[model samples]
Target chain A: MSAHAHGTQHFDETKRANIKFSAEALTTIENLMKRYPEGKSKSALLPVLHVAQAESEGWLSAEVMDYVAELMGIQSIEVFEVASFYSMYNLRPIGKCQLEVCRTSSCWARGAEDVVDYISKKLNIKEGETTTDGMFTLKTVECLGSCGSAPMLQCGAEYHENLTEAKIDALIDRYRSEGTRKNYTDLNYTNSK
Target chain B: MSRKLLLTHDNVPNLHTIDVYRSKGGYASVEKALKKMTPEEIVEEVKKSGLRGRGGAGFPTGMKWSFLAKPEGVPRYLVCNADESEPGTFKDRYLMERNPHLLIEGMITSSFALGANTSYIYIRGEYFYVSRILETAIAEAYAKGWLGKNILGTGYNLDLYVQVGAGAYICGEETALLESLEGKRGNPRIKPPFPAIAGLYGCPTVVNNVETIAAVVPIVNDGGDEYAKIGIGRSTGTKLISASGNINKPGVYEIEMGVPVEEFIFSDQYCGGIANGKRMKACVPGGSSVPILPDYLVCKTATGEDRLMTYESLSDGGFATGSMLGSGGFIVYDEHQCVVRNTWNFSRFYHHESCGQCSPCREGTGWMERVLHRLEKGMGNMNDIDLLVELAKKIEGNTICPLGDAAAWPVAAAIKHFRHEFEYHVLYPEKVKDSKHGHKEPIMPVKPAPVMA
Candidate 1:
């Protein structure tokens, strides 16, 4: 019996009823699980979580984590510990477009702060805050290995590199009009440089 | 103007396609490896080639392969470490993005040599597009009979898949990569029974960097002796340098091991000199983990000998005035950039990335970050410098992984080379508070050592 503030740890049966994967997503998870040897289907947990995140509302809720564990036939804490460890698995809700700007050494050396400031001003949101309309969330992440093209950010699978004010403006307007939740599982994603 | 073993056909149209890659003799290594040569012979060739691990450790690739234990029906594995999250390094992504099939071809040939029936390419999660690109290529490889079930009719059954990590820089370490792949927390395991003996569900496994696996293609096609003859001394073959930060041409470059550092920095073929026409201040020749070298030591060693890109020449001064060619992440800094600030930024990164398994790295990196932040913000006394140096020394060899050493080296090197800058921030707080980027170079006092009080 954990408190409600410890949302990821507490398992609510009503919330569990809401967890459902699409037919396509279920197939993807099953195929991923089959990729490993027998009884080691737990190895598919990371990839399955990716699929679960994409198929859901773009974050891992308590129910979603439990469903993933149950779906993989493991303990709920197994999924909870892993989701908490990695940077990509968003435990709470995020805006549709997650702008992960690189603020590490190379990117910082080449004006990554300016890029972050510009986006925060344009979206009228501070770093780690979401816009009122729920279209954008600004985050400053460490290096995404796009050092050659410094001052870059990742939205879903799209890599917006070589950031300028004009480029960021165009990116904001583009995502604003598209109005769809962007995610890492977007297979058709492209580098919008 | 260097020999391009990996990216020779980079500009070729449709190079990403299987037909074009095969037309250029792509799968020739697999054919030679599985169909003709014995597994032991292939290992011997790689040992003769003298290629070191391109992922920063500089361990001999062939020696590593030779160490794989083969005890009675235990399935061996070859996992390609595509977790390329090194701050100034992105060559693995570039190689995989540009020529996906080359890595696949390398995987097949290497897997055959190691007798691994199933293998995986563990790439970073943020590179979802690159994962898609690799998945497409792997699918193509399997379709063309280069990956699964008796590849090239050599009775070699193999299965290859691309596994993406969520986002963890620590996963780039081989054991941690295995841990993540096994669907667990990526805390790196202690060594005694190394990965070669006990890895990937208690089976023998050989983990290699993507570039290391891809280089196997050229090594098998041409004889290892021929590959060994390409570069200078023990640092054999061409290496991909991921050049970034304050440089005009900041991209990946494949250079012969003997290339002079001066030419590589100034030549139009490489970095094309410092950006904004600014005077060079410093450079981290390897990734952020290695020691940072000042301008004077970058092009030439402390002994007045010209610095070459080889492992030996880059590390000639032994961490006193020298650094390693680690991961080939050539990050340059100009005069306007502050060493103390950059050191702070890097310490912040290591603090954020330390897996927190070991106490010294966990606590030491946090202390170093806070002290560097105070020193950078012009809010500290001079004693903070000595404290940082002491903390780094305590943390250097105290962790389970090299990440502790990685976190320690940059802070120690920055203080060793730029103590005057830290003192300037303390002595002239008003001058530094507004302009942390770099408020003019500091003029040292007649007395070099700081007053303890």
Candidate 2:
């Protein structure tokens, strides 16, 4: 039921510094582009937008998406079309820590509804609402393929599996104290092993 | 006891690394296919092996490969489908996480067989960390001259890359996957010119599930005939079953086909019997999209034959008393679990995931979810139950892709097998609201409902 950002606004060059990818992110996008054939850099748009969203506070604003379009040599509508289609892409602003709970059949069979309610009551916000202090955002996503460890929630890029009410409290406390921003691109990319 | 083709070395330490993997004969298939076997020979062996797609459709993998429309000078592609978003499935994740090189090796051999100089592993976006694991494994392969140009000095040059897709379940379909690979919305294209004829970038492409591709490693290591002899007829080779939802040992297990459903659930080596020593009520033997089966029907077919894990045995009754071995996502429900609520959950999932390309799926799924929401909330009348069934029947076989049928089967099956539960909510609205979603109460039987005309 949630709506994502559309490319109603034009790209702003002045805000480019705030939306630029890190050096490592830039290299990652460049290498991803090479995976396609010549004149097919548009294939890199999904991964490139992932890098852009990760660089800019964990969600895609209009300007950030436009910049990703420019970087990937695609049009702005191309970026918006992709960013809105997938549930993983957060179009609007989100809190510092986004808690996406798996609310599909297997997880629901093993008490996923209770987990959603517990997190909602604990965080004092609804399923799609952010907290007052911008510390947390609650969302119910489809399957994340961790059904073996059912009743799970994914925070940032990490999956907290076989979750319970007690685990939710501990995770919330950990994230609140850490007080740092997280994004999908926060992977340990340099791990050779 | 069945043989472990896929998970034979799942417990090995550092199996994810290239050195440990190579030490354990990981790339032997790649070497055998590249240096010794011709492309036609490898394809012939696969055809002889009888490996099927592990991504729920159960189509023959060899047949899929032979359909490649190889026009001269246009580069072919071999894309791995790692978008394991099916609700009860996570075996591909387990395989990719524990043994990344197995998949990489499988892709290399497959690419060589198809003469696809390029390959991509299109993984789901939520598995970003697993994507990193795959990326590291790919880098190791490139360094060892296993993936990039001139692989293993056999004149078979292939390049493999990992592409991540954002969260769309419909992208698991082959054409939809190709569309997603081209960085578009995950909408499926109409077939007839299948992905083999006009796939990614309008070239010939072969898309396979991660497990289906990984099986190539064993199919090539052992002879194709030897691989074909592992399981029952047609359903050859081993399968990765991801057991979840109220099962005692809810994890990924590799089993040769022909194992009985009863032994699979109760055997100590597998699911360790149902969780909490509870009585098994029902199961979706495949992923959530498959029709569900009651406990009595799950172990035996309508004709009293013991239901084996093979595809033919699983679908013995043709959605009346049997289900499919689709994607091998085994979800067991104990007596405490409620079918109506679980069906509602799945309906909500399908509603959320419909790509809005087809009218029946786009509207019917939303309608089913809304009607089921009312039924689960105890505010529905008898008409709502009939409406749910009507919507499911109308939605089935009315879309460009099988997602329409996938969305419809669960709802139709739930009504067919658990109509008493739906009627209970309708007749006892007050009691339904009093009991929460997790409240465990036996479903009381009522008079048989009239079958749809």
- lDDT tens digits by residue: candidate 1, B1-453: 799999899899888889999999889999999988999999999999998999999999999999999999899999999999888999999999989999999998899899999999999999988998888888777778887787778789999988889999999999999999999888999996899999999899999999999999999999899999988889999999999999999999999899999999999999999998888889999999999988888899987899999999999999888999999999998887888888999999999998899999999999999999988889989899999999999999999998999999999988877778788878887777754446265332121344467
DockQ by candidate, in order = 0.53, 0.62
Docking category of candidate 2: medium
- Predicted model with the maximum lDDT: 1
- What candidate 1 keeps of the native contacts, as a fraction, is 0.78
Q: What TM-score, computed on C-alpha atoms, does each candidate reach? A: 0.96, 0.95
- Give Cα distance to truth, residue B49, candidate 1, Å: 0.2
Question: In order, what lDDT does every prediction score?
Answer: 0.88, 0.87
- Candidate 2 Cα RMSD after full superposition onto the native fold (Å): 3.0
Q: Where does candidate 2 chain B have its weakest 10-residue lDDT segment? A: B441-450
Of candidate 2 chain A, the 10-residue stretch with the lowest lDDT total is A1-10
